[model samples]
Target chain A: MSRWKPDGRGRLEKAALELYNHKGFEATTVAEIAGRAGLTERTFYRHFADKRAVLFPSDNPLPAILADATASAPVPLPPLEVVTHALIEAAPVYEEREDLVRQRQAVIAANPELQERELAKLAALAATLTQALRERGLDTTTAALAAEIGIAAFKVAYERWINDPDEHTLAQHIRETLDTAKHLTTPAEHAAATDNVSFTGQQGTA
Target chain B: MSRWKPDGRGRLEKAALELYNHKGFEATTVAEIAGRAGLTERTFYRHFADKRAVLFPSDNPLPAILADATASAPVPLPPLEVVTHALIEAAPVYEEREDLVRQRQAVIAANPELQERELAKLAALAATLTQALRERGLDTTTAALAAEIGIAAFKVAYERWINDPDEHTLAQHIRETLDTAKHLTTPAEHAAATDNVSFTGQQGTA
Candidate 1:
């Protein structure tokens, strides 16, 4: 949780999120956010490119952190597991910032444009993670599938973690969500449960 | 495999995709698309809301067709299997539109703004499919997981199907991709291959 501080960027972000929620994103302007933060428009611009930038933060290091973690795995892991481990390792970075994270999610949810940007951001993260996995020497399709599964785990886990009343850590939620998804895909279960359904793989080759 | 009929909507879509791909999405306008299609600007607006709408048809029936297919399944099926079947039944609808589909993909890939709209559309499709699954008596988590996996399969399969020179059917690609994703999650394989890794469900669970 963030205690409102005198720090310029922190104050501006808190103010912008609050204002955006209260008055709606379109009606709220840069000057009002700056005024609420007890700062100037010049100071707000110094921290972010514009009103939208306050919430999105163009310089956010998440993609780089994720890619670095995936690239530096000391052991050879299944592509998805490698990305999963990388995600958990990077989880702590956001543990302390849940308040801001929640606020950002709410703001993005309320606005379609913001929601689009959020998805584009997630896509970019997945793209970088895919490249990192490829650099680890996995083939193109494998790298893509692994990165996508990892990103899907991250997205679903973050939603559950934020929503759960028990207040579990982000890493725990990620692990649990990843575990559930992995189980859904396992071969042993697939054989037992999928007998009623016929697969094209059973009939033809690509 | 489409014969490119002279229908109004078809002509408009062809003209719009060509203009968007040629001049870029932002640079092209509704009037240009109409002019190229031999229609009036009013006719263009009648077909689409604006330039962006031209790229993503607002009234695409795939969601309804998919939801209907899922709801019409005669027997109880696993949530993912229900979706896989729905996708296959829906495949025949697009089998003849490969050329337009490929053009649309190229146009969307070239524009970030168009890409954002595309993501929003997919999210909307997922939301509707989730609702459809929930209507079939699945819990929220099961519905969400099933819908997300269905969308992922659709995405990955479409990409591979389009890129493959042999032109395998979309339904075949979707089934194969689903199978591959399922295999990635098997416990038996996890036991043998992932000694360095730990999945929480590795111990137990469905």
Candidate 2:
């Protein structure tokens, strides 16, 4: 068989998901995944640390994008708005890879280990967002709270979007989820001032 | 050596945490943990499935307490208030076992597998709350959204209570966090109508 070309990572991930779905995560092996991808064991190792890692291929640039989006957000935006903007910016990345996203979700749903890694990654993401908010001068508690809310909204939206593929774009679903959450928290009479609070800190990182 | 007692689960957990801290989770064995707890392997097996299970001692009673609190909560209490009552019911359990709580947190923090179990437990708790809410006839999405918010509040309250031992009671911290999250969501202008909305649902399971 011809050796798998340089795009071996993508090939391996696709192959692994199929095998995992058919044979079960525990029964699948590295050798099988590599063979299916037409790549050698060395090529698989060069891309992922293990078979599980294939399910959650890391995106090294996501954090930088999220950080930059938060930093460049309009100065007077409220914390929720700041986070909303960052999420909106990040939605395209997920949207572009809908198939891979679905496969990853399925794999995680099947295996407890993969699900745990997914939660850890989300927790790490929240921590990263909290740090960014803190850098903008929010107090530790507020930063953590805001980051949690943002992550919650993102989660709600993502799940809904994934479940209903025909209804709306991920970005729109996220925006709607945020609006709904905000509405639930806001009484109809007070909706006017919801946008008035400034979430960003005036003092730059010293 | 005398035969181990059934009520020695606590002792085993304590011993396990101490050993984990000193020797790491991967290196610790059931025999070592049992020896440290003055128990035998047979007794240890009677309480827990294995070493990792010791890290996640069952807290089965928490769900029933939370469900009862939510079911009997005063009608028309704000959404946050309803959740606060549920969390208040869970406080004594955690407060009474603060040392174990801290040790459990440390053990989970130290090991990735345990961390995942912790997340799964939290997710299960959230799902339980959501189901209870659905039983009250709330729409699926609203139920989920409320449960997510409640879990977020619980997390904030938990960390604060554990980290700052002198602070208000866990119940008080939970109420305050819910209120804070509420206030952060709603500014002064919306206070009037926000209070008028009746949050009660008819007693009917979805």
Candidate 3:
């Protein structure tokens, strides 16, 4: 076998997920993942720290992409609007990885430990968004609240998108979920004007 | 040694927190906790499943109390209002254990494993609240969004209550935090009329 295989990381991830699905995450080993990928264990370590790391890569770019999007969003937008912009900006990152993301979510759903780590990852993303907003001059309370709401909307949208039969874009689901959240929170009398608040210019019915 | 110690569970919890704080949670052992509590190891096992259980008791009553309060809140209340009522109802549970709660927070703060468990606990509480709201006839999306928002407010209020030098009550913090969340999410054009929506009748300024 060749010492260097192109796209070694991709191969390892594909193999790891397949193995994890076929033979539980805990029972699978690094050696098996590498062997299945047609690579060596050394290549596996070069790509990921361990089996779990294959699912949750440390180089995940979603956090930085979101923080940058928040910072660059049009000024004077409410914090949630800023966060919504960030989600729309970051949605493209998930566009090409729907299958992988779905598989990872399935693996996480079956394991309690992975579920905790996934929650921590989402919480860390929210914290990053909060800090980014605070740096943009929002108060701590407002920043944190907006970040949490954004994550909640993202979660709802993700659930809907992953299970959606039509294969709609993640951005579309995000827009719909945010609308649902806004509608849920707004008192009934004020609900009539819900559409007037969309300043993102990218809004469309999901 | 007496086989029966009054308040043995409380003693075990107190001793476990002290030992965990001093020696770190990983380095601490069940026997040591039992010894520190002036109880036998059997008594320690009887009160808690393990050292970690001292912080996260299986019988934690907040979930049931919050769910009950959600179910019984005055009808026609919005989902968020119902959740807020549940939180207010559960606030009294923390009133008598201020010091223990604070200590537990510190211990959990010092340990990542414990922190994960703490996050799981909060997430589970959110799930419970969501189910309770769904049982109250709200749609799944609305119920989930309200529950997530309520938990976010609870987290903010909890951090403030634990760290506040003024010793403000958790109920007060919850009310204030909910107002802050409401204000943060409300559009700026409609911010002035926020107080008009308070139909809970239990509202108070923090």
Model 1, range B41-60, lDDT digits (tens) per residue?
A: 88777778887776677788
Candidate 1 share of real interface contacts = 0.12
Worst 10 residues of 2 chain A by lDDT: A197-206
Q: Which tens-of-lDDT digit does each residue in B1-206 have in candidate 2? A: 44546458778888988998889999999999999998888888988988887766564678888788888876655444566778888889888888888877877788877777787787778788877766654455555666777887688778877787475678777876776566444324223322333321111210
Arrange candidates by lDDT, highest first: which order?
A: 3, 1, 2
Model 1 per-residue lDDT at B2: 27
Q: Which of the predicted structures, 1 or 2, would earn the higher lDDT when compared with the native?
A: 1
* TM-score sort, best first: 3, 1, 2
Sort every candidate by DockQ, greatest first. 3, 2, 1
Cα displacement (angstroms), candidate 1, residue A182, comes to 2.5
User: Lowest-lDDT window of 10 residues in candidate 1 chain A?
Assistant: A197-206
Candidate 1 chain B weakest lDDT stretch, 10 residues: B197-206
Candidate 2 lDDT at A37 equals 85
lDDT of 1: 0.75
Worst 10 residues of 3 chain B by lDDT: B197-206
Question: In every candidate, how many clashes are there?
Answer: 3, 1, 0
